[model samples]
Target: MSKKKDNLPNPFNEQPLGGLLKSIDGFFQNAFQNFQFVGGFPVYEYETETHYIIEAELPGVKKEQINLDIYSNQIKISVESSEVIEEKDDKHHVYKSSNSFQRAERYIILPFTISQKDVKASYRNGLLKIMIPNKKKRIEIE
Candidate 1:
């Protein structure tokens, strides 16, 4: 009867609770999977009126694997990974490789002039520290 049909809930208007839960579960699962691709790598930058210091944490990486370049008002750091292979037997083996990682270029505008020749760097405990010294005043002879 028309009255009985009206009393029943509309199928199209009904919410799919199971489907909503499934979608939320799927989203979290995919996010967790993607997080595994990104490991831990932190960079710290400190600057004083006289100098600047940049430190990077690079564990399990060699000093030769890192590259630092200085451009006008900017500094770029990058890391290159070496290929490694492991052979368990004639039919079983594993190959591990990674492409180079391009770090973000840090832009620093100096309050005063600086000289590239005065820049000094050191690596210790999986950390790379760079010290950039401000240019010294030169006395002029009249």
Candidate 2:
């Protein structure tokens, strides 16, 4: 009988808990990969008999930090905000400060065309409201 060759030590062997740990890590990474840390506000849209209304909730956002634009068939809303924090220690003479900025944008499409001159927007108490007149033209039958 021919002698069997001895197997060398394998470095590629999986540890008992390595696979489980790796799977858990991967799950967490994928779960939070596309998560937004800021800028995902809620919006509501509805239409009345003569006009369309859109409302957006923007808590803690100042009017200066918001930008609104109305096109012939769509509306665009953008918000930008920044925060700063400071810490001071008189005894140790140490001071620290940090700043963070966040931005978010959203677009809404209208079922019908709209005129820029007929659009109105107002912001109050953390709510932004927009009104667009409905101008449906009637077609005469031949």
Each model's RMSD to truth, in Å? 10.2, 9.5
lDDT of each: 0.60, 0.78
Per-residue lDDT of model 1, residues 30-61, tens digit only: 44332221443577877778767878777666
Q: How high is each candidate's TM-score?
A: 0.50, 0.62
Worst 10 residues of 2 by lDDT: 30-39
For model 2, residues 1-142, the per-residue Cα lDDT tens digits are: 9999889754444654665577557655644233242647788999888889999998667899899887778899988766665779999797756555667888999888887888999999989999988776679999
> Which residue runs of candidate 1 sit more than 4 Å off their true CA positions?
1-40, 86-88, 91-115, 135-142
Query: In model 1, which residue pairs have backbone atoms overlapping below 3 Å?
Result: none
Q: What is the lDDT of residue 72 in candidate 2?
A: 72
Model 1 — which ten-residue stretch has the worst lDDT?
96-105
Show pairs that collide, candidate 2. none
| Backbone Cα, N, C clashes tallied per candidate | 0, 0
Superposition error at 126 for model 1 (Å): 1.0
